[model samples]
Target: MRNAMWMQGVEWLAAAASDPQACKREWERGAGTVLLEAGRHWDVVSVPRQLGLLALDILWYDPLRTPGPTLVDSAAHRVGFFVPPDPAGNWAGADIRRASKGSWVAVPPPYRSAGSVEWIVPPDGSGTLHPPLTLELALRQANKTLAVLAPVSAD
Candidate 1:
C-alpha cells in the first residue's frame, strides 16, 4: 500500500523533473514540498560497547503495508548510529562516494554526522562531503541521495 503510493510519488517526481515549469512550481513551494509521507515504525536499541560508546541497532518498519517491502525490516547484526537533522530539517553531513562499480553513492544519515565517529562502513567508500544546502542544492542533493540510497537501502 505505502510502496504503491511512494512509487506514485516517485513517478510524479520523475515527471516534475522532466518539466521545467512544474519543477519551477515545486521549487517555489520550497521546504513545504513534501513529495510523500507514510507511517514509519522505528526501533532504536542501544547495546553497550567499548571506548565508552554504545552501539545502536536501528530498525524501521511500516505497519500500513500489506505484503510489500518495509524499510528497516530486520534487526541489525551490528550496531548503528543515530543521525540528527540540521536546522533546515536537512541532513548535515551528507557525502558522496564513488562505488567500485563506477557509480556515485550517498551514505545514509547518522553515519553522515559532522565528525569522524562512524562505527560501520559507509554505504559507498568514504563519501565526499556535501556542501551547505540552498533550495536548488537541496533538490539536487535529494535527487542524488534518493537515486543512490533508495536502490541499495530502500526496501
Candidate 2:
C-alpha cells in the first residue's frame, strides 16, 4: 500500500512531462532521470547549491513552512525548487535561474536520491507546490545569511 501511494505521487509529477506515458516507461526501464517541460504544471527556480541548502534549511525548520518538491543536481552544483506557474515570470536573483514556459528540467524518480540529479523533496501526490512569495522570502533570507557567512577579501 505504501509503495502504491508513492507511485501515485510520482505519477502526479510525471504527468508534467510532454509525454507522461513515455516518462513513466523511462523510469520503468531504470532511467536515472527524465527531462520534463516547465510552466505547464509548475515552474522551477534553481539556485546555487550553497544558497539552496540554506534556503531549504530555513523552509524546513518550520514544519508548517515545508516547501514543495525540490531537486538537487550535484553535477551542476545547483538545486531546483518547484513552484506554481507564473505567467509573468517575475523572478530575479544574482545566481538564480527560473525555468518557466519554454524551459526544461531534469527530474529524478521520487524514490531515487543517489545520482547526478536527485530529489531533495519529492512531491506528495496532492499537487502541492511552494508558494512563490514564501519561496522568495526564504531565498532572500538565505542570501542574506550567505552574505554574512562569506569570507571577507583582504585588500
lDDT of each: 0.26, 0.85
lDDT of 2 at 4: 75
Residue 82 CA error for candidate 2 (Å)?
0.2
Encode model 2's per-residue lDDT on 61-148: one tens digit a residue: 7776567889899999998999999734446878899998899888877877647888888887888888887788888999999999
**TM per candidate:** 0.17, 0.92
Identify the candidate with maximal lDDT. 2
Q: How many angstroms is residue 45 displaced in model 1 relative to the true structure, after the best TM-score fit?
A: 24
- Point out the worst 10-residue segment of candidate 2 by lDDT: 86-95
Supply the TM-score for candidate 1.
0.17
Question: Among these predicted structures, which one has the highest TM-score?
Answer: 2
